[model samples]
Target: MRIFPARLPDCLILQPQRYQDNRGFFQETFRAADYAKAGISEPLVQDNWSRSVKGVLRGMHFQRLAPQGKMVSVLRGEIYDVAVDIRPGSASFGQWQGLVLSEHNGHQLWLPPGFAHGFLVLSDVADVIYKTSAYYQADDEGSFCCFSAALNIDWPVTDVIRSAKDAGAPDFSTVFP
Candidate 1:
């Protein structure tokens, strides 16, 4: 497995080595020892999975009081995934990194705590799975609009589908004081 840092150095793009044969393929998606080497000492306590159709956009979301670092991967389709730095006082604060993740690429994105995560489904349907360092706490939820003017993210999609919560997220400030 190899790891490359994204534009935001704290975030990483992980390439897991896949050994393929006539029968199928094998690879280690996550190994505590290997992850520890990458400075991810937190124990991933929850694994969440979601499926969305094309044009669906979710997030720019995070947990404020109990921030959760995430390792995101796509299992069945493709998505334009993004991570934004919202950490106070950090050099890269307000910066973001976006990339395509799909089953074909066999890539995983790692977003450390203090970053907001979002993705737009590019395929007919997408199945995404992520492991979080901390269990989810509804009361701690935080969200920023994927299209917030302050961030001015250049989202590749035009016809977008978002929940009311995500639509209202634009009213929230991306910059933490």
Candidate 2:
């Protein structure tokens, strides 16, 4: 696996080496030692999966009490994945990075505990799976509006379909202050 540091140094884009044959392709998504060597020291405790249609947007969400470090990848189709630096005191606070993730590329994004994560579907349908360092805590979760003016993320699609929770999420300023 090759781990590349993202624009926010703590975030990582992990690419697994694939071996292909006439039958199919094989790749190792996670190996404890390999991940530890790449500086991803957290032990993943939960796995979550979601499917969305084109124009669907989810997140810009994170937990404050049990912050989760997540390793996210696309299982089918494609998406524009985003991670925003929200850690207080970090030099890049309020900044974000976006990447194209698709089944064909087999790339994964490792978002450490201090960032908010989200994605927008770019295909007819997309399936996303993620491994999280922490368990889900409903009372601990929080979200900033995906299209908050303060963050001003340049999401690929304009006509987004969002859940009631996400649509009514607080803005970045409200989240931080």
Per-residue C-alpha lDDT of model 1 across residues 85-153, encoded as one tens digit per residue: 988888988888899999888899989888999999999999999999999999999887788767788
- Give the residue spans of candidate 2 off by over 4 A: none
Clashing pairs in 2: none
Candidate 1, residue 174: Cα displacement in angstroms equals 6.2
Count backbone clashes in candidate 1: 0
lDDT of 2 by residue, 111-148 (tens): 99989999999999999999999999999999999998
Candidate 1's TM-score reads 0.94
Q: Which pairs, if any, clash in model 1?
A: none
RMSD of each: 1.4, 1.0
